[model samples]
Target chain A: MGAILEIKHVSKFFGGLAANSDVSFELAEGMIMGLIGPNGAGKTTLFNCITGYYPPSRGEVIFKGRKMNGLEPNKVCKLGMARTWQKVRPLAKMSVLDNVMVGALCRTNSLKVARDIALEQLKVVRLDRKADFLAGGLPIGERKKLEVARVLATRPQLLLLDEVMGGLNPAESEEIIQLILDIKKHGITQMVIEHDMKAIMRISDRIVVLNSGEKLAEGSPEEIVANQAVVEAYLGSEH
Target chain B: MKTILNKLGNNRGFSPVAISLWIAALAGLALFPQFVDNPYALHVMILFFLSTIMGESWNILGGYTGQYSVGHAAYFGVGAYTTMMLMQYRQIPPWLGMWAGVAVVMVVALVIGSICFRLRGPYFVLASIAVAEIMRLCAVNLKDLTNGAEGILATEIPPFKIGATVVTDFLSKVPFYYIGLSFAVLTIVATMLVQHSKLGYYFQAIREDQDAAHALGISLSFHKNVALLLSAGFTSLAGSFYAIYVGFIDPPTVLALDISVQIVLICIIGGIGTIYGPVVGSLVLVPLSEALRSNLIAQGIFKLGLASEESGVGVFLKENLAHAHALIYGILVVVVILFMPDGVLGFARKLFTARNRGNA
Candidate 1:
């Protein structure tokens, strides 16, 4: 299908340092694009630029057919793009249902309708049983799930997840992989920033590797694994 | 007791008994002026209603939206001055002038919100205080518009009328009492509507996490401004009511930092982000302060035989107790913060639940 999101040579400079430099990519509709990078690889910075958390110092972010540069994050979200933070930020003082209801409220003005959408998304993440529990009191695994459920309630066409499984156990990571696959079945485009190699390979339709704020390589999973440059930049020369 | 409390707090729907209780309470309040003739008692009741309006208004922004502005007096003072100016200098009656006050307060809120909402945490607090201080200074210096620091004294309120008939002359405290009561109720109902609506959810989301709320399509500036406008509007109403009731306006009385802090204390001492928090807070604070100001507490001590009438302690109590209300308020706030971080209402709820468990 056609591309749903396009990053055209995007670069972000914080004072003298370049957090992201000329990173270019396109996320095709209904596809899972894995963004793998080493530490300080500018993955999260790129996500911030694309999601309008920060305006890129250079280049453009086109969502659907509109230029998204310099737009606020809320405006970007309203235009069918949503993102989750690297550190799970749940509305701690609010209940799980209420937290998700806030996301669903983007689509409707009625609290009841927002609540129903929240409940439906909660069930998808298997968090329906903890609907009344405060978002802040949940364990990390559950907080990750809550992050997913909340963004899902927004009904975004493109979802960007930043290190969602960073601290998750093997079993939890597996569950998230399955969840990502399930989301793909819904035909929503996704860009997953992850450090876990096997999990990324299993879910991504295409893989882009980044090293020190620039794209190292981009290809199918097998092509990326066999590419000497990607292996050297990501796994080191000894690998 | 547990069952009754649960029935009262139930979210399925309003219980019949609860509804009846509310109606009865409202009816009693509406008819209170008929049976009471003591001006002091009426004055105290009006003060209670004034406190309720201020607390409820502050609770919308500071409690629900987590803006925690300590500069609400800017809106309060602006409202008072606007209404007073129009009534004293221009020919407009206060009833019409209060709406003008609300409109003026909205513009002030927008300017303040734009300046302060850019800063978060302690910075936001500081910006709010600075803005309010600036407003207070402006009020003090603007001689032509605000009558300078000399203040304006409204000699008399015009009579209320409907279609050629005078409804009530502003002779006794009765008219002011009803007006205060109605505005207080209006603020309470407005708060309830906000808490149960989608706007409340967005506000709370911004409070909990700004970035996450933004990622969910809730604009921080937009919602914060909305909260401030609503809060400032109600607070302006309280200001207009106070100005008209007391017939006096000055920088210290209406626009001081103390007034702003008092508005916030009403919410913090009751419970923030809950419907009845300000109500409970106002109920506790107004009577306590009134008693202290009137030296009733010292008299109660003497009457209860805790201190002899002619003793040195008695002399001290009678001489200094009335002026020590501020000190007492400070100590009370410290005690509440230390022992009950959730405020009086939350502390009471916790105690009740623990007692119920013990019985079980």
Candidate 2:
């Protein structure tokens, strides 16, 4: 299939520090691209640049062949690219259904239609039962699920999940892996920033490794595991 | 009829009994002047309605959208001054001039929104206060336009007319009461519509988490502006009403920082983000403040034999308590914030659910 998103030499700077340095990758349609990096490797910053939360200091992010350089986050979302935060931000005082309905509202002005979309997504994430519960009261694992359901309600063509499995138990992480695979079955392209190596391997069609804000390697999961530089850069002296 | 009752009952705790009670209360309020001919009681009712309008207006932005604009006096003053000036100088009736006030407030709200909405949290609050203070200063200095600090005083309101028929002669408190009641109802209905709409969800989303709301494609600037416009418009209407009813408009009276604080207090004291919160707040604050200002509270204390009229405690309360309404307000706010951070409605809800659970 065709590439749905292309990141070309994207670099982001905060003062003199380079948060993302000349990172380049292409995400094909309907494929799950795993982004793995060590701590402080600028994975989240790159996601920020790609998702229009911040403008890249250099290079381009072309999504659906449109250059997304200085667009606001809301504009980027309306253009069908939605991302979840690493620190899952739920609308705490609102009900869980309302949280998802906010995302669903991005597509339709009708509260009834948004409710339907929200409920459907809630069911997808198995949060339908707790739809009326205050979002702040949810556990971290379920908050992550709510985040997924919310973005899914936006009907995004491309989803960028920043550490969706972070802070989750193995079972919870397994469920997210299954959810990501299921999303792929619907043909929505995804780029996932995940720390769980085995989980990423199982879900990712291809993996791109980042080391100190630069792409260390990009290949299939088997090829990535065998890459010596990636092994050294990521695993450090332990590998 | 049964299906309609069931529908209303099923939707968000609006039981048939509650709906009937609401209808009864509204009917009583509508017919109050007919039963009670006392001008002082009618005056108190008008003040209650005015306070309701102001509080409900502020609640739209501060409570639901979480913008917390402490500078709402800018809109209030603009509305009061606009209508008063138009009537006193240009010979326009207040009914028409109120629309002019709304238009001017919209422009002012947009300008304030552009400047203040760029800042978040406490900075936004500070910016709003600063902007309102600037507006107050302008009103004080601009002698040619706003009549400077002396302010605009109109002794007579032009009688409203449709063709040859005069609607009212502007001689009675009765007309003012009806006008205040209608404005109060309008604000409440507006808040209710906002609370139940997608617009409210967007506003609440922005309030809960601005970044998350942005990611959900809710434009922070756009939604915040919409909330501010709705809030400022209603507040302006209240200002116009107050200017007409009170027959005076001064910078200190209409545009001061305390005016903004009082508006916010009305919502916070009752509950923010709920339709009835401001109404409850006005219900408590208006009568309490009025009683304090009129020394009725001290009179009641002496009448109840809590203190002998000649006692030092009684003398001190009787003499000083009228001026101590502000102090009482301060203490009340502190108590509410300390014990009921979610405000009265939320606190009441917590108590109600806890009691129900205990019963179960």
Candidate 3:
């Protein structure tokens, strides 16, 4: 499959610290790429650099053959690339449907059209019953689903989800996993930063592992599981 | 009670009852001056409309967009000074000069938005206050242009004419009353349009979470500035109206920090981020302050036989309350903030919902 997004040696720095260094990956079209790492391994930082939340200190992010190095997050979104926050930031006072509608509004100017699109997205995430409820009142698992629904409404070609299944129970995580599979069925490329090994292995077509702000391994889930360096990185971090 | 009222108000499509009530209210306001010939009453109504215009204008930015600009008086002062100066010095009529005020304030709003929108939270608030303070100081120091501390006294207003037919002479409060009323209506309609448009949704998204809105392709600075331009334009119109109606324009009268706070207070006390919030705020504040200033509340207490005018409490109310309007206003604001943290409308809605739950 042809690549939809190419992260070429991207690095992010914070003063003297290198949060991400020489991190490179290629996400193929119509495939789910799982990004896994130990705690503080710069998974989110890499996502930020790719999505235009932060300008990479080195290298480039090429999405759909366009360099997205210095564009703002909004501009990047308009280019059909969108990312979800690790901590879901719902428009807390707005209705759940309205929060999704905000994302739909990215593509369509009409609120009526946006609302219909938002409703369809909410149905995909199975949050349509709570569509009228205030977003802040939703539980964390539902809020995460709402975040995915929101980004989905933007009708992005490539979706980056930042630990969307984090903190959810197994049942909730299962639902999200199913939702992610369903999204893939819609023919959209996805990059998921997930901590759950079993879930990631089940869903990801391929896996890339990072350690201490650099790529440790990149292969299929079985190959990644058997890689010595990937095993050692997790083991070393736990100790 | 408030829940039912909210249900009526929150109806997505127009209800017959709501539409008729609105029409009746507008008709009553239109015919009010003819029935009440008392100049003092008309003067109070004019002040009411002026406050409504100011409050509604501020609501566009501060309420809908969640950019709580404490520097709105900068636009107000600019509009008043612009119109008054042109009329007094260049013999330019205020009708033409008001548009000049709007144009100037648009530039001012853009400049201020560029600076202030860079900051967030308390820093944004502080930056806004600083910008307004600088404008006020410039108005004070620029003696040549602003006529110094003595202020501009507009002793004459050319009669409003349409195609050589004199519409109204500047001799009575009736003309000023009608002008203020129309401006107030204009602001209300403008606010309603913004609230229902895509602009309002984008603004509220920014207000709820800036980063989330940005991720959804909403340009933060661009949309915020659009809101501020609309806000400042209407605010300047109110300022121009005040200058023309009151026949005076001074730094304190037009550009004071208190004026900025009052504009915010009108929105906050009613409800922020709602179209009718500022209107409700003006209705509550204008007459409350007027009654307090005139000691009408104190006199009404005596007239109702609550106390004799000679009694200690009654005498104290009559003697002190007139001057204590500001203090009372402060206390009222504190009460609203403490008990009704979401402002009156939200608080009332919550109360009604809770009571309904109890009954259920």
Candidate 4:
């Protein structure tokens, strides 16, 4: 399958500090691409650049043959790219269902229709039972699920998930891994930033490792595990 | 009693019962002036309607959208000045001038939104107050147009006419009452439509989290401005109503910081982000202030035999309570903030839910 998203030599600098430097990657259609990196590896920064939260200092983010440079995050989302924050920010006072409805409303103007779509997405994430509860009252595990459900309601062709599994326990993480696999079955392209190596290795069709704001290695899961440079990048960071 | 009230308030969407209650209320308000001929009563009702319009308008942007502008008086003053100036200087009728006021306020809202929306939190609040202060200063100093501190008094309001038939002259308070009622109803209906529409969801999302909303394809600046425009437009209408009905327009009266604070207080004290929040706020505030101002509460205390008229407590109440309206108002606000941080509606909801849990 052809690439659904192409990031060409993207670089984001914040006042001379390079948060992301010369990062390049392509996410193929219907594939789960795991983006693994140590702390401050510019994973979230790259997600920001792709999602148009911040314009890259230099580079092109081509989404389905359209240039996404300088577009606002909302415009980028309209073009079939949606992202979650590393820190899940749910509409605190709104009900869990209403929070998802906000995302679904982007696809349709009718609240009734949006609610239906939102309910369906909540079921997909197994959060349908807590639909009436305010998003603020949910625990971390549920909130992460809610963040995923909300973005999924937007019906994006490409979803960039920033650390959805960060603070989750092993059981919750397993559920999310299964959820990601299920999302793949639906033919949506996903680029996930994860710190949990085992989880990323289990779900990713392809793995890309980053170190010091640059792409360190890119390959299949087996090749990535075998790559000497990738191993060194991980071990060196521990020191 | 609490459970019954909770059930009624919790009934979401348009059930048959809700629709009937709404129609009955609207009808009652429409026919109020015919049954009541007293001018003082009519004047108080008119003030109630004006307060409702201001509160509801402010609620749109501040409550729903989470853009708490303490500088709404800028638009209010602009609206009042626009109508009063056109009427006084060029012989334009106020009915025509009110629309002009709305138009000017829209432009003013856009300009203010562009500047203030860049800042967030308390910074945004301070920026709004600063902008409003500048407008008030302009009104005070720009003697050429605004007529300076002496203020503009509407010596006459041209009789409202439709096709050569006089609808009503400005002679009776009843005409102003009906106009105020209609404007109040218009604002309430407008707020309801927004609450049910896609716009309301976008506003709430932005209020909850701007970045998250944007990632969901919600344009933050665009939607925020849309809210402010709607809010400023209706608030200008209220300003126009106040100027015409009171027959006075001054920087102190229309453009002061107190006017803006009062608008916000109405929303905050009632309950923010709910349709009836402002309505409840106006109902509580307008009457309480009036009663306090007129020493009616003190008189009522004596009449109820709570205290002898000549007793030390009664004399103190009679002497101090009338002059303590502002102090009492301040105390009420502090109490509400401390005990009921979510305001009255939210506090009531919590109580109802707790009671239900106890029953369960």
> What DockQ do the predictions score, one after another?
0.86, 0.92, 0.84, 0.89
The deviation in Å at residue A160 for candidate 3 is 0.4
Please write out the lDDT profile of model 4 over residues B204-271, one tens digit for every residue: 99999988999999998899999999999999999999999999989999999999999998988889
Candidate 4 per-residue C-alpha lDDT over A34-80 given as tens digits, one digit per residue, 9 for 90 to 100: 99988999899999989998999999999998899899999998888
The TM-scores of all predictions, comma-separated, are 0.96, 0.98, 0.96, 0.94
Off by over 4 Å in 3: A237-239, B1-12, B304-308, B311-315, B355-360
Best-first order by TM-score: 2, 1, 3, 4
Badly placed stretches (over 4 Å) of model 1 are: B1-13, B357-360
In model 2, which runs have C-alpha deviations exceeding 4 angstroms? B7-15
DockQ-wise, the better of 1 and 3 is 1
User: Model 4: DockQ against the native?
Assistant: 0.89
Measured against the true chain A, the candidates' chain A TM-scores are: 0.98, 0.98, 0.98, 0.98
Q: What is the interface RMSD of candidate 2, in Å?
A: 0.5
Better of 3 and 4 by DockQ: 4
Residue pairs with colliding backbones in model 2 are: none
Which residue pairs does candidate 1 place in steric collision? none
Q: Write the residue-wise lDDT of candidate 2 on B1-360 in tens digits.
A: 767876887674468887777789889999998999999999999999999999999998999999999999999999999999999999999999999999999999998998899999999999999999999999999999999999999978888899999999889999999999999999998988898898989989989999999988989999999999999999999999999989988899999999999999999989998899999899988998898789998999999999988999999998899999889878988999899987888899999999999999
In Å, residue A17's CA in model 1 sits off its true spot by: 0.9
Listing every candidate in turn, what is its Cα RMSD in Å to the true structure after a full C-alpha superposition?
2.6, 1.4, 3.1, 3.3
